[model samples]
Target chain A: DVKVTQSSRYLVKRTGEKVFLECVQDMDHENMFWYRQDPGLGLRLIYFSYDVKMKEKGDIPEGYSVSREKKERFSLILESASTNQTSMYLCASSFEGYEQYFGPGTRLTVT
Target chain B: QQPVQSPQAVILREGEDAVINCSSSKALYSVHWYRQKHGEAPIFLMILLKGGEQKGHDKISASFNEKKQQSSLYLTASQLSYSGTYFCGTGVMEYGNKLVFGAGTILRVKS
Candidate 1:
């Protein structure tokens, strides 16, 4: 079975604080993605990595960066968290652009 | 661009049936469906490619219309466990491997 795990289920951070959300997949997929889901907004892509050290910006990448130093791990970084950045963060991995397997999301609260 | 979903929300009884539609303005290479239960990660339902194939899992099924760039999900004899937010992610050929997801449709099933 494919397993995707996130570093946290919930997190709280003060404004202007740095935040990191980690994801790891055991399927050895080549594609990994970061998305933020908000009510009535669905899942909007923040960033994606196709290979180690290879990153691409999705539709909404502002104030966010991603790292893919290894194949199994992907990390999302918020340069300086703001209240508007509060959202449910989801990490997904796919093999060869197929159906994605998602991790339990991290609900971030930026106060 | 994000796909458009019809009927923002729906409510059904345990034995009732419902349909959710997703349409995109751009030409789509594939359509992926997911169900996200409350406080859980989204789970892959199915993927419909450009060939306009119909796929099913248990009592749930989906069809894609390549000509119209549309897809529809059908849930028959719905069960309480079927309650969730349904999202359709569209893959555009020009967009490479990324999928643009629609604002999801919320489904609630009552016994």
Candidate 2:
């Protein structure tokens, strides 16, 4: 079975702090994505990488950055955490434009 | 642009039926559907790729209309396990691998 594992299931950070959320998928999929989900907003794409070292900005990419140095791992970084950034972050991997398999998600709270 | 989903929320009893619609303003290569239970990552339910093609998994089914750039998910004889937030992700040529999701439709099932 394909498994997408996240570094943390829950996290708390202070305002202005730099935070990193990691996601690793065992399926070796070519595409990896970072999304933030909030109540009523659904899942908004933050960023995505189709290949190692290649990244593209999604609709809601501000205040965030992503890294995909290796084929199996993708990272989401918050340059300066703020209270408004608190939400459930999800990582997903897919075979380029196909259906995606997702991680368990990390619920982050910024204070 | 993000697709618009109708019936923001719905309630259904076991064995009932429901439909969730997703419409996009831009032409699409495909429309993907996913289900996210409370506090969890979204899971791939199905994908509609061709115009007028309908597919089903278990009791859940979906249809795509290429001309209208719309898709609809049909849940027939709904089961308790079908309760969750249903999301439609649109695939646009300009967006590449990014799947911009809709606002989502929340579904609640009662025994």
TM-score of chain B of 1: 0.94
RMSD of candidate 2 to the true fold? 1.3
**Residue range B1-111, candidate 1, lDDT tens digits:** 899998899999999999999999998899999999999999999888887664436667888888899999999999999999999999998777789999999999999
lDDT scores of the candidates, listed in order? 0.93, 0.91
- Residues B1-111 of candidate 2 have per-residue lDDT tens digits of 889999999999999999999999999988999999987788889987755444336657888888999999999999899999999999988778788899999999999
Model 2, range A22-79, lDDT digits (tens) per residue? Answer: 9999998999999999889988999999999999998899999999899999999999
lDDT of 2 at A100: 89
> Taking the candidates in order, what DockQ does each have?
0.86, 0.90
Runs of candidate 2 exceeding 4 Å displacement? B51-56
